[model samples]
Target chain A: MKYKSQKVAYWFFAFSMLLLILQIIYGFIMAFAHLGYDNLHPVIAFNTARAVHTNLLVVWLLSGFMGAAYYIIPEEAEYELVNVKLAYIQLITLALVGVTAVIGYHFNYWEGRKFLEIPRPLDWLVVANVLTFLGIILTTLFKGKKRTTTSLVLTMGLVFAALLYLPGMIWFDNQTMDSFFRWWVVHLWVEGVWELIMGGILAFLLIKITGVDREVIEKWLYVIVGLTFISGILGTGHHYYYIGVGKVWLIVGGIFSALEPLAFLAMALFAIAMYRKGEKKHPNKIALSWTLGTAIVSFVGAGLLGLAHTLPQVNMYTHGTLVTAMHGHLAFWGAYGMIVLAFISYSLPNLTGRKLYDSNRGVLAFWLSNIGMLGMTVAFGVAGVAQVYLERRVGLEFGDVQKEIQVHFLILIICATMFTTGIGLFIAEFIRYGQPTDEALIAATDHDA
Target chain B: MLSKSQAKVFFLGGTMVTFVIFLGLSWNSLSKEVPKRTHEENLTAQVVAGKHIWEKNNCMGCHTILGEGAYYAPELTKVYERRGEAYIKVALMTKTPWQPRGRQMVAYGMSDKDASDVVAFLKWIGEIDLNGFPPKPDLKK
Candidate 1:
């Protein structure tokens, strides 16, 4: 916000919000469809709705990550963005490609590869878009007065993520080969590089919100990064347990992915320890809540829940059941989703010079969304366990098990309503803050002083 | 308790080790593990074309191949063996939407050629040695 070029991030964040709302709508469509109200089945269909839901979640999270980079890189590197116009162009092209791909899903014009479902042609466009994004970030960082570990880690994550996408794009005639390479993009991303992004953003937020020195904060970032690499890299084996991979993966995946929780646990402890040590006088209490919530919740959602089924013995039963869905919902929400909200909470006021940080709606949004998502996780867990027992254990039909689990969708719908309401309030507060302005830039600097 | 400089070196070393290990494991899988199961000679032109047809239609979005997709529908990994090629073709060719009491499967309105090719792709996948995944538990025990 101190720099004029940073205003471009506001548009990116806005686009992220737009996509999030669309993602939730798709979530509702599937939730209702699960409840036997397949009214939209003819139009949207379950598979198409699911594709849109998951793809939108990924797109919105990426957009948020891009926005976070734009805002954080300039401030951390002590320079303005290299080319604001190119960043804007990148944002528009990203949106166009995302919309086109989502539309293509409805018409059944996409690759069957989950998460990498965007057609190969559009995948090329995504590569170009991300390269432009990384170009702006890297150029600005190198040209600036300082290149902190925080900015470097975030940039590394973005760069590695772009590189990983290439493996998924490679054409493999063998389904096993295709599935194997696909995880290089999917698993390596959430468990590997994205953790670095989370660390960078979390470190930046803790330093600002806790009044902690950069040295202490950046030191913790290293530990998180260390633990992340130690466990997350081999954690890719976890997904290979049932795939047409070698039997060695059964042990490699279990042992390594089981240890993946340590990184998240360290993150939780790091944030809490930092909070306890520093002066808690940062006036933005809501931002502080979100920052702490993200750390603790990620440990629970990603670490603990991921560990729940990471072992080969347990995963043998829950590989693709609602059990996986249960873990996926919480892990993504706790780690990526909440972290984005924390970044927005911290940056929104500075960007707009609005002190709407202490609003009831803001606090309510945090609690309701989190509590709602937790409820959704529990419902999915119960349904998933039942599914494992009935279908896998008792040898009932897949269709029959789904019928038995129909009651859980009612609970899911209720929880989703609460989650959606909280998100709505957060978006409302965002809109009320109005757009970034020149006056707000001066105000932000004065507030910093 | 470590200094910032020490922490940096420590993390850098750790990252390198992890990356190297990952690369080694991936290389091993490609070279040793996959070759044991992959019959390159079996992957005919028709199967390759069918794989394209499968990708073009986004079958994995609903039906899991080798237990790696949405579980709303049944696992299609062994569907060719379970239901046979003719049954799968008839199911795919049936224009009437197979709206089961539970999760519904949309008819892609696929042509006979496309349906047959997809079946071929499934058959090709079924032939691979999967290391006994989707392990069957004895209920009586």
Candidate 2:
């Protein structure tokens, strides 16, 4: 909102929304497929559906992060983006590459790596796209008048994420070596660098909504970053446990990953503490709701739930079961997903010059999505525990266990419907706000003046 | 509360320590643990080719190897011991796509050479020392 160039983020966010819708559709496909409705099995097999679902989730989240950077970096650095046109070009290329990769999965033209199915050729495109993005962000930051801690942390996360992608691209003939390095990308990004991104965004939101001093907010950002590095870097060992790796990872992974929740807990506490200390006079209650909601919910979903199965003993039984799906759903939803929603909620009105944050629709969207996702988590949890008992403990055949668990998909479908409805409402609000306009820019500039 | 400068120092120092530890752990795994059991000598040309085939086919999208993939399919880590390479080849050749008895396996229409290589790759993985993961469940009722 501070600069005309910031308007470019709107397209990125819009693109992300489209992909999210596609992701949810694939989610439904898988859910129904789980219910024995393999009607689409031949064309859109479960594996293909899964690849699209997960890959779409990742791409949309990355797009959201890119959008956040575009919006935040300008304001934080006190300047317009150096080249707005290049930013637009980057967004288009990113979308094109993402679409190509997702489509390729249908033809089995991808590596089998979880969360990293993009074929090598497309991977190179991704690298180029990200380089363009970082070039714009970094050039703007360095060229601007000032660079804040929040901006620095966010930039560091982006840089590390870009670097981490290399390990996954490296071709290895040894399966163990390949799996070991793949986690360097997947585990490190989500648990390590992405936390920095979340913290930076959370700090920016809290400072804005709570009317807190930048000093106070940035102080907590440091603590969160500290806790993140202390626990998260070593936390990569968690995924190393059964991957034909050495045993030291068990102790290293278990102990460190158990501590990963502390960072999230610190995040929750940081947000609440800031809110309590503020004057409580920000008129944008919807944005405040999402900011606070992200904090508390991420703690539960990512922190507590992550801790539940992080230990080696528990993980032995639940490594790849629905238990993982249980943790994965809530963790991603609460942490990155909610934070992106918070950013969108906070920035949309300012960009569009609309003051629609107090509507019933906004509140409904917040509660419906949170409640629906929580229900889905519970559904996945129950099904997962039952699965562990029946399949792993009872030694029932995998197919029988899956059949036994089909009933849970009913609950999953119902809850997912609610979640999707909430998302639909959120997107509706985004559309209602319309596009960013010159008048909004004038208003923002006048308000600042 | 720590001052800004103090907090910055603490953050930087902590980050360095964390990095050092991570490096240490990774080196241990690479130098000692991986070498101890990976048995580089046993990794034949066929095994290496099989690993590529496994990745090319996106097998890990469904079947887990060493408990690290989608759980919809059975774990392939021990498949060599559970079902021999011959059975695996036939399963691939038939392209049944689904088993009436258990979870379905998609027919990838893998060539015989590819199938044999994939089996070799799984066998190589199964031979590595996992340091006691997927520990034996107490089945004695």
Candidate 3:
């Protein structure tokens, strides 16, 4: 909490990452726990495990965004965060809130939505925390003399990410109305506002690490955000297709969500253009690769599968099956989630003043985490396709369907194990890399700000 | 002027080839009408009523049919073939139900009429030409 000259943002990013690790562990456990018989499920049943996993992921991703925001916003604005202590308090409070929500979830006090599982009370606290965090960032961005252009895009994204939570609270009496409002939070956040955040973060990272011209970076950010909102807002229709909505929503959601990936592809091209057109050799090359990789992979996994499922005809075959789960797992982890992880990786070593991450071991850790997740994505998608065949096309019982893909389940289990081990390697590498050097400790003692 | 025009024609030819490749892909994935089913007027009312029960109860959230919705229970499209409509109705409404071992359909908390309606709905679907698609997931014994 008390680091000198370093923006205290990295702590929040690291803390968020710890929560992500917990989520992967739980996801693995839930997969195995499905091998139950009769009308019996463990106390930490599938529903309960899922609630905690998804909600924790949301909180952690927010932490990552806030932490990254704290780091980049100040630097982008060419100033320090207005009240660093208040930001620290917000981080601690968020950690506490995460604990409460997870405990409450085990007792079945949860909303039934897939990812939006926090109870009403927790949601209120989270919303307030969000406002406070965003407030600090905005005030910091306010009154800066030579602010970089990326600051505006980052601020725009954070504000919307907070503001978009409004529609989620307004549920109606009927399920149809409820479903419509529910997706305003869920679908819009992922497709709409989250993309904006990812765009801002990626652009900022590129400009900072690649030393791209401010004008070019700003133009890229504008195009990315413009494309995000246009494609994303309409993309919300994809979820509406099966939720007892009218027929027109199908056309709207299908086309819009399907079109959303083009923006991401554009983002990748922009990143490459920035790198190719760089002036200075960037100090931290890993960070640059991570920032660009997150954008491209997210487009490939989340955006592509989202397109597949958005089509009313294709969704007719893939809806609510393991195929959906496959898409969600990859998209959620790779897109916005990976961007957050990248921020954590980039910020932690810098904050600690430890020259530990620029090493072979650290590089291997990054590769393993990326490759493990890729394997998990492939296994999950393949297994889901197999499941679509067995359960939907072929007449097989649900329990029997599980038996049919015992092989797939095993492969997914292996994939999850690999992903988990990869996470372990990341945590280990981060710990080793974040260890403060003797020189840094001596300097810290002498130069306590 | 002749050289540029010739180049334009070549470019158009390449674009045409690329467009055909793209269309060939999308043609397979694009939406199409469900091949006409043998709809029986006698059972349409029953099936429609059963659809009501399904919608009312939020059963699709837990069960799937022809590759749609949640995957908690066996699909109902071929229920009429596996178990006669009479048996399906009985199983749906049976007060003393057997424990679902392997892929078994649970006894829905339904009355006799509700069960009959569902049976009618399943029979209607069972009568359809499956085309070349595989059989529906069933309550395997």
Candidate 4:
């Protein structure tokens, strides 16, 4: 128990949070440059900023999640991490690869797809980390005294996510084929394997916090897993609809993606039910609020907006617009962003063994982020819809329409700044004063049983 | 967290309701939209040959006709409207490659015939009469 989980994990989580901070800052800058139909600064163009926003978001979240996994998996398995050396290596490898990939993107050495940013060689490095992490998890799972179903599901989700990523990165002579495969990575994981991770991790965390009966939570877990894959595979169809695919795809994507939200909804309901039915109360009220809020927003950001564009008719208007960005910013930030943050909050105290981590600051960050996200989503969505009306229906020049939407884009910039300040506050709390008082620790412990 | 009994019923109801709504929406989409291929209807053998070249080259990789390909390149659905067949053919064959920002297709060094083929292919896709096929170009990108 003494070997270092919390302190070590905080560093990695902090590392990733730093990347996320960069992502939001760059995202705001880009939004501003595009604001008011004129470039605020042409030097850091919209395209360049977008590249930074997306890459930072992905890498940052992964780093935080990896840190959390090392701590949680060991405890759940009731053993030390199977390979501490390999975990360090994994972190080093990830850091090196991420840096190189960002540089590569800046220099335009990309494969030209949005999500599949790292070119092949660095991609190989990423794959290596994934496999090593998977190996560690597997060894621990098989060797452990406890083999919880939740841990198994989470490990498998990680494995499958890596599996999906591999095919998408392969080089193809055929551009269309390459593009098709590229989306398989981005869409498949977010809509597919990653959701399994979300479900399993959320389920495990809920149990620790709420002391919900394991049997009841386990049953709900199965439903979540089932719906995740069922709806997820079909969710890929939504991207397919516009990609030189036939009408059959539209039908398939629309139906399946529509079904995808149900899994999200299930997760929300399950979390709420557990909270309501809890015997022991959660000690970390702020952590619990974040977890709960994260779940609800995941349903809204990933589910509702997702459903809006799954319809071919609606996608006709919204497909490439800021509407898509509107959905992506919220969905990614809400679902993965909050899930990983919850992990950081939950594991930080235990790892650091520092009592008196202020839970209120985390709560403040949560609400601020949620508010900023809502503002961006609403403002951009309205702009996108108005754009569709002007250019598509009323026949205005697309350039003119771009100018028109710049005003709303500015609002997005302001909201993003607010969100960034909130994240900074959370990070400060995380670093300087995260170890909670003894009373809180005892409560967290009592709540677990 | 539902009572073991209560959870099962709630889960079942949620799943069934979601499935039904999705199915209903999909069915409605398929029934409502019908596509007419009138644009590809009147095509010359040369244009058809050009289309074949396009298919063989997988031009969609770099050039998106109607918001469908890799964004690394530009949208080509409006290409004919922007530059017509002659300019398209000449540009494709003529190596006016801007070294700093070279295109993905430029390296393939397409022949005049190949350029014509891609032009034809772009024209063919651009002419689809589906009500919502070509979405408005997204500025957010």
**Best by the lDDT measure:** 1
lDDT of 1 by residue, B30-133 (tens): 78878668666788888999999887877777667777888677777777887899889987888888875656778767889988888888888887877665
lDDT of 2 by residue, A154-204 (tens): 999999999999999998776778888999999889988998998999999
* Per-candidate TM-score, chain A: 0.99, 0.98, 0.92, 0.94
Q: Write the per-residue lDDT of candidate 3 for residues A1-449, one digit (tens) a residue.
A: 22342355767867876898888866775566444332334355455566667777888888888878887776666666788789889889889888998887766566554456576688899899989998898888886555654676667768877877876765333333445567667876887677767877887777666777667777666666666666776666676565444455567667777788887787778878888898776656567657777877787778787676677777765666777777887788778777986776666555666655466665675677777777777776776787777766674655666776656656677767776766677677677666434344234321112
Q: B44-130 in candidate 2: lDDT tens per residue?
A: 999989877787777777677878877667777777877888988887767667664544567767788888887888788878877
Docking class of 4: incorrect
**How well does model 2 score by local distance difference test?**
0.86
Give the CA lDDT, 0 to 100, for residue A261 in model 3: 86
TM-score of each: 0.97, 0.97, 0.76, 0.80
Q: Give the better candidate number (2 or 3) by lDDT.
A: 2
Q: Each candidate's iRMS in angstroms?
A: 1.6, 1.8, 10.9, 8.5
Judge the docking of candidate 3 as incorrect, acceptable, medium or high: incorrect
Local distance difference test scores for all models:
0.87, 0.86, 0.65, 0.68
What residue runs in model 1 are displaced by over 4 Å at the alpha carbon?
Answer: A446-449
Q: Superposing all C-alpha atoms, what RMSD in Å does each candidate have to the true structure?
A: 1.5, 1.6, 9.2, 6.9
lDDT of 3 by residue, B30-98 (tens): 222121233333445666677556544444434554334444455555668877877777777876545
Q: In every candidate, what fraction of the native interface contacts is reproduced?
A: 0.65, 0.57, 0.13, 0.08
Clashing pairs in 1: none
Real interface contacts reproduced by model 2, as a fraction: 0.57
